[model samples]
Target: MCDDGLMTSPTHRAIALLSLFSVAQCWSGAALADRLGVSPRTIRRDVNRLRDMGFPIEAEQGPEGGYRLRTGGDHYLAVLDDAQSVSVAVALLQAAAGAPVTSTADSLRAIETLRHLLPSSVLSSVKSVHAASGTVDVGWNVPPDTRLIAELAAACNRKVRVRFRYCDSRGRVSSRDVEPLRILTTGNAWYCVSFDLNRQALRSFRLDRITELTVTTFRAERRDLPDPVRYLQQNLTETPRWPVWARVRYLAPLEMIVGEVPRLYGSCRSAEDGTTEVTAGAEDWDALAGHLALIAIKLGVTMQPISPPEFSDALVRIGRRITSFGAP
Candidate 1:
């Protein structure tokens, strides 16, 4: 048993020693031995092994005698724990899903490199995550400019103001300056949550619609606003008070349809007997019926319209269309 343990334990001990050295400036032999539950002699042997691998581990002799990864050792190699490796792999997969053609190629190459380096056990878990997870395109074909996204992220991190030329959905163009607060991703689209300086209100700008982004030297004044994620969700679901709204109940659980449907379409809530109720607004009965039909198809559940007879009639018309597909 002792001989078997000796053979299998050195690799894990070496990895733990490296992790400790990476995080701290120095660790004494006694301290490392105590931490790894090994003798000072074993710690010395592991340190020597790490040095043999070109880790640039340094030792000093004195009352404060210890070991450390030498200065510039970071330039030699990078090491990742299991969790960090899995994080990188999952992030690369997500990036590849939404990235443009060229960026996707680079992300794939990095993922392949990670797979080659990660342990077989960890690589299996990473592959499972990749297999179970998926990205919804939401019909966005053009990926946001990576440079612009990076600049906006930096400005947000620094709490700075940025100026950009924006074209709204109606084809109106304007130059605006704003304090970049947060960048949010809903599906494949990216939106910048900002405090518009000119309008003196919070605004969400779609990244693809923004151009000529310039991060200014001016610092941003913090404002008391709702949490960025909650604010975005509210803005996405908020509808005009006077619009035609319909309430429908689905024979499905709230978790089943929560994120699958965009918040812009409606708000979902749990109902009695494990059903979900969706309240959505539309320009007219036809539009509302169409939305409900699409939601039903996506959820694979029967929907019972709760209000507005016009909406029920419109839903019947949609049902006819579905039946016509099978007709001669």
Candidate 2:
């Protein structure tokens, strides 16, 4: 009833064009008008406004080149420094690296998009980190099927709306419609944070148990969702899956890996020897032991298969069980 024409309609259209460039492969004003149910004249007005706002929209003549996105159309990513680029790359690596199924894939795609957007010098700096990077793997548990994880993560990051089969604590399966917000890893599990359309609440679904997933059309209210990591600590799964508790000392001062790989339970205490000892609980002792073995850091882990034994014999048994091929 009211006239948006004099106020917001044109402004909204212009912002929408910029948003299109921020995401897709290509966009044309004529096609855009068809999508928005407006005239090509209004689309032209909006396009010019977007050009004023610094969107490098390419409008070609004759016939084929109706409209296209130029390479540097996004001005936001062009300003990052070399160090910032590497830092972002590290964050992307951290996000997807530990999530069992190529879980951090969305972040990786964003990382690539960012890398391509950066200046050459900044990109070189980002690449330099890979070359100078030291041994930093914490051997986090990730999903075995990376393809599915990647697809789910992409859906969540783009707020693409999704549906997936979820197994409840009792092992019963149900289909859930979710607006996946983030992919998070804690200790050994990968979690998907989303707003549940059915439950009308925010829920964390375990990614490993997610057998099937598909993108949906139900978009989420992107602004109000909770942070994924905060949601994990609050919802800590009710199943109480892990049964073994392990303690280990870090090779370097505990401060080194503390920020990167934190203890699942108590404090990772520092010893007089400059190393830090960490305590953790896991349901599968052998699997936990395998994680420690890959770190290969000396004295880094001692599995306690049975509670109350601080000695190495029980841990040695667990290691043997996991390795299986090792001597008795």
Candidate 3:
């Protein structure tokens, strides 16, 4: 919850997704702004923009009732800085040049926004990447929940409450009253770190199944302290990443593998032994295969212990699998 620090904008796809959740929700403008981490005026402006784009936003009569989306608008989403738009447009066109006709538009928009937001010197190597990929077209899956994600981001930044149904790891479903902290997209999945007032704890919720994200004023007015990236790296990971857990004793040095892997386990001089110990956490047992292969480099390695038999089994299995493959 550290001040929702200024992390640079990722892709337009990410932004579009974060902002689209509030489209058809019933909530006050003030409350909406809080959820989006912007001034109330910005919420009004967003509402106006949606309305201008032909969305059917119904305004309620009294203060209790709030504005909501009606339906069927042609507008996608746009958050560009001008310099970014031009460059993005070109890059997107190039990226989507051969995609199936369906995802081309959304992919194109993401590139366009990047170009619009960046300064001229921002991507000195843009031409190089573009040239290398010449006619190479990247097929991508644009999440079906982009609009809702976009709106949710806006709501989170604005400190407004958001309502959505959550599907957890065990596949249990429940309605959530969340004060969104930050959005994390680490493992081919998107996560929202938030204060689950009901649970009275910080939790990471996935974005894919966060159905119907509508703005809520009931609890959003209260301030929440959340640092999304740290929270995500700490939580919201897929199941438990046992393969990600590594304990390696290196005679050479820790700096060698520092860039090669996530430094989940800080390197330290062993308490009794004179070797350096290092560890990392990944997504699953399957991921450990790669890390274990690095053990062939003459470094003594083992999986760090977690309190679960399954986690231990996972690591051993990974080792056996790589060894079976004659990993060198």
Candidate 4:
């Protein structure tokens, strides 16, 4: 009988011992026996079984001594449970579908690795699950250079400095050297948040607008900055100071209309009365009014323009256009 008074299979006991040693680093025979609900003698027998299968389990004597898995000439194959296998398979499929262009090769490699590792039955089930799943691809506003993104990502992970040419919205191109920090994805675009070494300030560079990316040998100096996601949210969502900016208050909740509009187009605030205030900027009143009308129509709610009179006039013009349509 095992320590818990139940018959334990040798396979189960060996796997348990392997897991325990992997996690705890070392475990005495008595501790292993207690954990597995077996005797010290059974633990020894299980260790021997693992050794026979080429596991490098080393044993030592004394109070501080126990069995430990040591580095050996042989490689260790992962022993995954059913759930783990399924999870890995599912992840591989998803990555194959939606991973960035830069990561496509790596994703494919991972998928192939999982395909070889998983059993035939599990692979078939994973395939079935993948075939049934669907995703909508709205496409990126600007496709980033895959190789540049991959290099920058690696540089960020390694705390390295990188130099790159950047083009601003106004078409002004400049060279910049920055300490790679974090990469952020928002509103169908990727931005690299980095500390600009030349400017000595924090900056966000759109991956799509980056060029001539070169990783430097110099390690980056850490900076005190807000969380990567939060910083990106604040910078990315700031309304542009266009000449014809307008604020509109909508009767519906913010959540009802958020998905219908792009975050770059406006900033929204919710009120206690379930109403939403949207502040958007555009080059002209007509453009702003058209967006407002679209939002009102999409949400099926009334919106009151609370800005420049030109916006209200634009709405009137839209109404006139609608009323005059198909008229003699």
Candidate 5:
């Protein structure tokens, strides 16, 4: 598109080329030359210029060969227009608000750097919107390490093997060597779905519980796997590791309970009797009872315990304890 009287100098042509490479995975030399209105020889020279400037531009030989920019390189600067710049600023602000413990500082520093680079007029508008907007904590008490997440993401993208020490929910520690596949978030924490080499099965690890992470040099062959997000959802919902599973019927509408409960934490549905049913898991009956108690307190409503005699007994115990607290 820049070939239409906009690309005047070689520098402008190179910038245009960089912009093109950023959007798509690969572009043939002939197509690039045609788009830039330059000779194939000129395109080759521009590619070389970009490589010399520390952009990891990978070029292949032959007719079907093309050039692509690789991610996780040592140097990468995104070229953004004014609107794109404003969008990035807004996204960074949101990220800073919800980012994990270690990454909040990084997000704030990035916002500061981008503000300094933005034009004065654009910066003024961004500042006004930022002043009007406020952030709420998402209640992420135990978030994953930012550096570990980056490392695992790079390994997944590069298709490499990684080894890490993992502590499971039962406090059992084990060393795991696996091929990192995908990293997903449950709005509160991060999880990595990987193929476990030793166990010979697919596994999902909570990123916060991982330690001693090491990315190996071995290239991992891609396996015919199911959709990653689906796999993660099934793993979380179907195979809960908690010991106690309970269902409670809240005397509220389904829509109201759905907004209050995160999907990753529980599943909610409307009962035939016009109450909302929520099925969730907890480490023990006491913990489950406490959670339900907190919900009742927060919503100022009643919850009919659906099942699990243990949970009901625990609730009675908790009620007696509260009654005693009032007496003495």
Candidate 6:
């Protein structure tokens, strides 16, 4: 038996031996015996057994010679145990749901092949995982073109600048030259977080809106950047595009609102008196006021507007309208 109790069986040992061979360039017979806690003769027998099973294992006999698997052949086989195969199947299922790197049809076909190859118990586990995870309908489920994403990703990795035409929310198109820093996905959409050379600032461009992309030969100078996701969220929630900024004092404990208010809406911090202070930006006073009312109603707690006195006035107007509706 092997030192590791799990791979004691011949089948398990063969899998483990193949795993080692795949990673290393070569392993001597004595070294293989020492690692598996078996004699050199037993290792010989195991090698013969794997060869009979049609694995392209090559053996050499000398001080430097040992065993290695062949590659780059038309008749290649993927070596995976039941558990690893099931894991790959689950990953394929997620990719099928929506992965920028793979088309849904390709992922689904791969998943179906895995299902046919997996054992009954393993298939059941895959089904359970899919059922438990459920599904989400992200508003914009369309991913960016896979080839376009590949180009942008390569630019980011190469630390190179790229030029592209971008369309903003108002349907205006403009050319931009930027240093591609990262490719990020919010599940609903994909974005390329970059440093705009022309604007001389960090910007997040929606991948769907990008066109005429060309990778430039210019190398980009690295700059200190905040966490990409946080920076993008800040750009979305705190930018001048959102005209009204409002602060609210929640009467509840900080923990109560921390999870309820998403970061894209605003930032939340604990106040001195054990309350949660949220600073959010919205289109207008009425919009912010209505947002606060919805949160307060959901949390079943009282809240007061803390800034831009107009927020308080808007809240009063909403309350009066609600009261008038009750009178009718």
Backbone Cα, N, C clashes tallied per candidate: 0, 9, 49, 2, 0, 0
Per TM-score, what order, best first? 5, 4, 6, 1, 3, 2
Assess the local accuracy of residue 81 in candidate 6 as a C-alpha lDDT between 0 and 100: 57
Ranking 4 against 6 by TM-score, winner: 4
Better of 2 and 3 by lDDT: 2
Question: Candidate 4 — which residues are off by over 4 angstroms?
Answer: 1-140, 238-244, 253-255, 271-274, 282-285, 313-328
> For residues 1-328, could you state the per-residue lDDT of candidate 3 as single tens digits?
1013321222332343223333324667666655545666655666666556444556786868877644333333234433343345344544466456645655544454343224454332332223222222112233424344445655665677788888764567999988876654432345577888798778877677788677876646455555556655554222243334545445534454444444332233442444445554555645654554465344444324433454457657766875789755
| Residue 134 C-alpha lDDT in model 4 | 27
- Name the candidate that leads on TM-score: 5
Q: Which 10 consecutive residues of model 1 have the lowest summed lDDT?
A: 132-141
Best by lDDT: 5
TM per prediction: 0.51, 0.39, 0.43, 0.53, 0.59, 0.52
Stretches of candidate 3 off by over 4 Å are 1-145, 169-172, 184-189, 217-219, 224-246, 263-274, 282-290, 295-328
Instruction: State the C-alpha lDDT per candidate.
Output: 0.71, 0.57, 0.50, 0.68, 0.71, 0.70
Candidate ordering by lDDT (highest first): 5, 1, 6, 4, 2, 3
**All candidates: CA RMSD (Å):** 11.8, 17.2, 18.0, 13.3, 14.7, 12.5
Q: Global lDDT for candidate 2? A: 0.57
- Please identify which of the two predictions, 1 or 2, would achieve the higher lDDT against the true structure: 1
Q: Answer with 1 or 5, whichever has the higher lDDT.
A: 5
